[model samples]
Target: MYLSLLTLNSRSKRALTESSRPYELHRSLLKAFPDAADGGPGRVLFRLDVNEQTGSISTLIQSEKKPLWTRINGYASFVTECKCKEFKPALSLDQIFRFRLRANPTKRMKSTGKREGILNTTEQVEWLRKKGMNNGFEIIDVIALDEGFVKDKLTDTDNTGHNTNMFSVRFDGLLKVTDVDVFYSTLRSGIGSAKGFGFGLLSIAPIKE
Candidate 1:
């Protein structure tokens, strides 16, 4: 059983690339406190340097989006920590890391392949790949099920109400899964910014061979 640790700090050259939609910490600051400015402390947008499970600094704007494991909002959109706790899976048979993954075949909207019921995990994977990442990545399986095993309404109510409409995948083979950073960044991100990114981690339950 082997596990590899990976970290990212944004490409310095890539960071300097031009951007029509510039990222301003003020965006978050403004959103956090709309009336704090023009008088008192003005507005205070906190850019926390959260150390993710992978030891990577939260550089992108997406570092702020929380994971769903806490509230079960549906599929985690960003990189996810490999949480092996809730899974009571019996992997003795094939000792496989089974999950679902979709591919976005285009740059437009539905480019992330056709989803079975709803939500598009395809696009999410593509977004991460485009950012130049390769953390034992693979779409081991793809189950277009008409039913899911979870419940409704994420804590934020941001996903397809029915959990049935989701793509599941696993990372079990020769590697001990660590964390997964999934999100949508349209080939554009500022220097040291999350741009359109999201990430998270997961604990692991290695399948016994």
Candidate 2:
């Protein structure tokens, strides 16, 4: 019943395009654990929390108004896996992330959902290039799913409320992306609002680092 919301910097959504900051950090344990100094690739600690929201990864982004120009359309959502071949401490809740839960207003509560967190994944990835990656670290590897979370979330699970897979890994990664590639619509009709079909990430958990 609780959905946490995180206004992430699209760029940070490395799993979407580049940089696996968290994954790389996790790999640190094996390469630098017990030797994790300030600048060394040692065992580092970090915590990430996602805010509450609604709708499927596909239902979110209503348009591309960020640059207030380009013709960006449709948002994207996908799972990313980092190839940190080596890990000593092993990625756990402590090393991966401790999810913070929050209650985000549903479509019924908010008015502008579509324009809020919906945009093209490719365009998003491209935009991020201009924004520049500056997390104070180097990126190792990345694997992005071509499909959006909304489309991917309900693919395996029954969209029907009776057997909904509300808790699936659409865009799995170490650090979090502010706009985890989702769609929301507040409009009653038109291109933005889903009318009733909307989705968001839930019960997010990190895999073994």
Candidate 3:
């Protein structure tokens, strides 16, 4: 696996446009990995982080293959810095870490049998807890920050003519690995839904005692 950090010049118009439209940004990021350009099976997960006070913007990308960021046209002009590093984390049962996940939390509607965004803060936390249960980890403490809704046009699916809205929530907290194998898988595949729109990437760091 490879981890990349791309710092973009907020003053660039292109950066401003893509940042606001996650779908476009996702497409732009895919250019770095040619194998994924044709809608291949390669998985690329990313999370955009913005600092409102300093107006700084950076994106964290995790992918199965190494990315050639220079392939993205005009990257040198709009991107201030691009760094990529191989990632391999050692895991063990009962290991604790601080983690962050930008996920589209949702619940299935009993009547419609369709998934709906979960709005309640309490429910959002519960959603993560439930995910942890099945993903081989246990949430020790966590908080959810509402990130509003992400809007994008559906170009590929059957709902191509319409625009879709996905509620976004940011989760930050501490977790303990209950099952190393399962937790490792979760780290690679991510959590929750709407992954294509910058949701479901789980970032973590070990908590030093």
Candidate 4:
């Protein structure tokens, strides 16, 4: 496992295009690991953090072997820096940490027989609550950013010939690791749906003692 951070100028047109079309960005990111280009179980999980004025991309890549090369392009400056390091956390039961996640919270509407995103603030919170339980973590304190969530229309068209809509919510909270193995799996495989569109990358930091 490798953790990587890429800082991009929000004003750059190429950055804007890559941000809008997550599929394109995914392909671009995979360029680093040629072995995974054809697609496999081992892949990269990425999240885009953006504000009204600033943005950055963080990714967790899983590869059995070291990548042939890692590179990034399309930035305001000629050199687009990408920092990477081995990701190996020594986790234990009841270990507390501060966590941040950009997730797509959704539920299938039985009435409509269609998968629908959770939009209400209360529902959004509940969605995360359930996810935490299933993922082997307990949320001690959590808050939703951007007024619960934001909606994004994917720039690339899907099989239906229509843009896919993604509902993204940022979660900030303190969590205690319950099941170490399960938690590790959650960290690798990610949470929820629409992972390709920059959703479901869970990141964490140690809590100060």
Residue pair clashes in candidate 4: none
Local error of candidate 3 at 74, Å?
1.5
Which candidate number would show the highest lDDT if scored against the true structure? 3
For each candidate, give its TM-score against the true structure. 0.20, 0.20, 0.93, 0.82
Candidate 1: lDDT over CA atoms? 0.26
Please give the CA lDDT of all the candidate structures. Answer: 0.26, 0.24, 0.91, 0.71
- Candidate 2, residues 64-152, lDDT tens digits: the string is 11111111112122221111222112222123332221111112216543333323344433322222133111112222233322222
Off by over 4 Å in 2: 1-95, 98-122, 125-143, 148-170, 176-198
In candidate 1, what are the lDDT values of residues 1-209, reduced to their tens digit? 11112122223222222111122222322332223352322312122233536444332222222212223222132223322112232223233353322221223337676434223445544443442234423333333322222122222346444322122222122222232222112111111122111112222244446
lDDT for model 4, on a 0 to 1 scale? 0.71
Q: Once model 4 is optimally superposed onto the true structure by TM-score, how far is the C-alpha of residue 67 displaced, in angstroms? A: 4.6
Worst 10 residues of 1 by lDDT: 183-192
Q: Over the stretch 66-167, how does candidate 3's per-residue lDDT look in tens digits? A: 888988889887799988999998999999999999999999999999999999999999999999999999999998999999987767766456688999
Query: How far does residue 14 in candidate 3 sit from its true spot (Å)?
Result: 1.4
- Which has the greatest TM-score? 3
Q: How accurate locally is residue 101 in candidate 1, as Cα lDDT from 0 to 100? A: 23
Model 4, residue 143: C-alpha shift (Å): 0.5
Task: Give the 10-residue window scoring lowest on summed lDDT in candidate 4.
Answer: 70-79
**Candidate 4 lDDT tens digits, 1-209:** 77777665555676677666776676666666644345642657787655655455434444333443334443325225556678888899999999888887888898998888787878888888889899989989999864333334444454444456667778899999999999999988888987777777788899887
The predictions' CA RMSDs to the true structure, in order, are: 17.4, 20.9, 2.1, 3.4
Cα deviation at 7, candidate 4, in Å, is 1.4
